[model samples]
Target: MVVLVQKLLGHFVRSEAYCLVNGKDLPRLDINSPAIWKASVEVGADTEAAMSNWEPAEKRAFRLGARNFYLKATGYLLARLPFQNMTLRSLRCLSPNAREEESSGSELRCLDMKLPQVIQPGDISMLMDEYTVFQLDTLESAENIDECWRAAFDLKKCDGTTKYPILSKLVKAVLIIPHGNADVERGFSENRRLLQDRARLTLESFNGIRHVVCYGERFDSDPSSFTVTPEVLKVVRNSKKRYSERLALQKEQSAKRPREEPEAVPNSEGQDLQKEVETAKKMLTNAELLIAHGLKTNDLAEVESGNSLLASGKSRLEMAIQKMAGSKNSLPANDLSVHF
Candidate 1:
């Protein structure tokens, strides 16, 4: 069990990104590492030995042997920790027998049983100084009420033997009626109600229900604080709107553009057309070269080259027209000689 607990602790430490243990961040340790195994073994051995010595016997020669053993073991465990001090005498006086004392003799015996020293108001005051007190109401006819009252009164006694009065000094401790799994049964009832056949539940639905039960008030009271802001919504809406408008404009432009038919080349004009094509190609080439050089020098020479190319292509078209007019006598080629 100790090994299992230690392994679980290690697993939890690794799974939680923000968790710290013993004032240090968790180190990366193999689950089956030798050091972890050794620590688990040591802890298990110590716990087992303590439990074995502390285990209650079914029958004993001494009247309070089992009780005394329990008290001693508890005291040993408590003393090892950085908390309250405990002793055997204080333990016995807190037992059921001590409270039934009806005479002075029995009272003196109870006082005598208080070992080491008796606790006093100063002790109680010191404990109260560090702790808070809560009052609970109970039924007058409740079972074991007398026993409870006796225990509470005995706790106030300062005598060290039977009573140490440390209860008064305790920072905090809870006391309640003895009930057999009532709270557990109530929780099961609530679970059943949430998971009934009428609910048609999935894992998500169950989780939602659980969250509501745990933090519904906080959620319902201030939903905006836990939800996305209006500014975020506005940004999302604007981005989507801009994207849709850009797509629509592209579609409109595509619809408006006219498609041109492929033109055939005429054998009579082929030489002149070829010359024009060559001149256009050279202009394009020069423009690309200029663009490259301009890019290297971070200048606008490429833009000027492109404009000059356009002007040169226009001039070449005018020269081709004049040549055609000047050579009107040279017979025009038939349409059949033209090839697309």
Candidate 2:
């Protein structure tokens, strides 16, 4: 029972990318190895030979099971491990490409889209060239990913600056990725504590407190141990000034924006009808004035225009009154009608 458990566990432990890259004590497992079937080398001649002793049906079942396990485990690891995908494994570990004929084609295209800033389109060729040299340099020296990146960063040009600036940045970004969510969980806990007692905190205030907490935690410093240097005093003094400036800038930006006219409130049917009545009254008064002017000057055109205006005003007034009456008729009988 112990031997069976160890054999299974050995494969799982060896499957880890970190263990492989770091050259951990556990030897890499081969599916064909007889040791996989039995704990000790003395137990079997080979996997196939040992399987020959079993029933034909058992042999077929074991092969099928192994095939399925390999496929499923490979897929699961590809998602979590960087540079361990079938195409990408060649980049970091110098693993032979599955398709060596197509090796000349862009391998960067298959890169996980997690680092857009680090891997720009124009720098693709340069990045590949740097990675080529990086592989050769770390062929034996690199014990782990951290050392590999440190070596990459150590590569200097004529001016003593990093040879592969972009690649170095990419490596740094990748290495900084946390293996677990412990830090994230802790951050959520801290945020929860800050928000207790129905506390009302502004975004700026929350961020400031978060920054202070992070700074103290990172340096392992107590609040009392913090030094109040001249720079700190200056920053403190100018804080209000900076705040005022920010407010002024915000106001200026708001003033520059095009003002949108307020939406006109929709009038109810009753209100619309009332407005129409008022408009008709105004039109009638204008028509009467025109008629009076025509009578005084004896102009036929003016008199004709006044008559047309008067007809239009009368029609509008009648329509509005009819609509108002219709609306009233649509309403249900009130309780007062029961008394009647």
Candidate 3:
């Protein structure tokens, strides 16, 4: 246990920290407090020696760190005190603005609603006094504050309940503070995105763009669906000074785009292809007749059909003229042939 104590004190003898209570002289912290433990261990050497002669800046930093530590340790409880007190005052139609109670230190700061223009001054002195007594009584006697608040909130603001107006105003002020900052931050971000890198934007032009982007954000998935109306264009033209002949010019350009063009057709090459098709048709007919003649051997009726075709006075070989009337020297080395 002595070795453990020595080990911890070895660390704590560094920081300058002690305790204060009841406005009395400072007291050295318990060894359980790490700051004092380390200071004690390192004393009479670097730690305690430095405390005997603290530089101005070092002293400032030490005090600041101590203040921060004190705040962290006790701030949550202190913060709740005012909030609870204000809520209690609000619950009984007693305004926090009505009080000017002497307050000192950061922890006990009270509301300063002195300007009549700010709170619209009124006389609710009796209500304030009654509220204090009621709150004090409730603190001692009421069980389950959550239920008490619910009952208080349920109190209707009829002709008899004079407290409701004051309570409602207080509730509005208290409830909106935390949420209000988020709205302010959102507005700041919107301004940043709008105003950055936009050197040409005057206040008037910026107002127009603000309206455009806000209303047009709904069409963000397909921004082309958002047509600039005449009014919108007018605003831009009035700001930009180019509104007159452009609308007519834009309409003319838009109208000319959808006119149909004449389809392209090649007259010369098309005629040659047409002639080739007709020649292929004639050859195919002659070839079909020759094939049908070969089929006649199996069917005599087909042969009769062939004989009728042959009566056209054009024998199949005569159509080809394969035996050119010339000697072997006159014959061409290659002959025309069709591949399957």
Candidate 4:
């Protein structure tokens, strides 16, 4: 049991790019894509002969565990396979004309991209030669690869025309691919669940429910900072009471699956960034709603309140930026990506 667990876990711990999404840095094609391809290549290298008297049952269990993870990671990567292929083709060296190569890893052979007339093959080559060398040089000076990659895209030349437009586009496309959708996918999944029971939910109802959930979370995280509204308290307390009663009843009545162990939580810096980002979003939405309502009713007070919200949102954003600047070694996840 222990050996099987180690073998299965070893693959995942190394290939965290399968699930950890880092929006700030550039994507390494060697690491991010074709996880199963690498694993399959490796599986044969580790034979049953290495382990004395390895039984068929043990082999079956190991294979099952590995395959389960392999299928999920590969499926996720393959779904975005075209994007991954094009990114590789774009970034690789010029001599081999990846389009012409038989071994070009494109699962979908045709990129079928409507190429922008401005960005030609020559442009890609020139950028690759210059930018790749510059990125490499940055490696010598900077402490790590990540710091160097960020420095590579620190665009300074902002004349009338955007500087290195084509390169910037490529960087955004390739570099910004998430290590994993671990953080972002949950909200939408919950949204679907929230709406499942109600077929006729209006836009207002949808937004309101979402806000309640969001506000509820914020309130839980820092009770001192969050305004404790009576309505929110009543709803939370009542909901908790109901849920506790139901959960206990369900456990008594039927078969209960063991609770999955919780995943590792991000550090404090990350949590703060996430909170500020959410606060900023909430404030912006409040501002929008106020302004819209004020316009509809021609109410001066409501408009004034909205302007205040806009200011508050800006302040939250600035604070988040300050936190980032303060903690370079342990900077937070990209929260601004959610909004703009």
- Which candidate gets the maximum lDDT versus the true structure? 2
Better of 2 and 4 by lDDT: 2
User: Candidate 2, 266: how far from true, in Å?
Assistant: 36
Off by over 4 Å in 1: 1-7, 10-27, 39-240, 256-340
Instruction: Supply every candidate's count of residue pairs whose N, Cα or C atoms clash at under 3 angstroms.
Output: 14, 0, 5, 5
lDDT of each: 0.40, 0.52, 0.41, 0.50
Any runs in candidate 3 off by more than 4 Å, and if so which?
1-109, 112-118, 123-130, 133-151, 156-164, 179-184, 191-340
Q: Candidate 2 regions off by >4 Å? A: 1-112, 117-129, 136-140, 197-209, 223-340
Q: TM-score for all predictions? A: 0.16, 0.36, 0.26, 0.25
Q: What TM value does model 2 have?
A: 0.36
Candidate 3 C-alpha error for residue 186, in Å: 2.8
Compose the digit string of candidate 1's lDDT tens values, residues 66-139.
33443344335333532222222233333334333333223333433332133353454433322222122221
Return the top candidate by TM-score.
Answer: 2
lDDT of 3 at 297: 31
Worst 10 residues of 4 by lDDT: 105-114
Instruction: List residue ranges in candidate 4 displaced over 4 A.
Output: 1-145, 158-166, 179-188, 198-340
Candidate 1's displacement at residue 92, Å, is 46
| lDDT by residue for model 4 (1-340), tens | 2223234334533545433432212133233334423443234454645634777787767766665665566435434444434434444322223223434322112221223333465665655454444333422355453454465456455565544455556445544443456634554355546644243333344445655677867767576678768887666666666666766888876556666777778666767676666667776676677668766754433455456555666677777777866765444355565452
Candidate 2 lDDT over 175-259, as tens digits, reads: 5644456855555466556543212233334344555565567546777777656755554446545666767988999999999
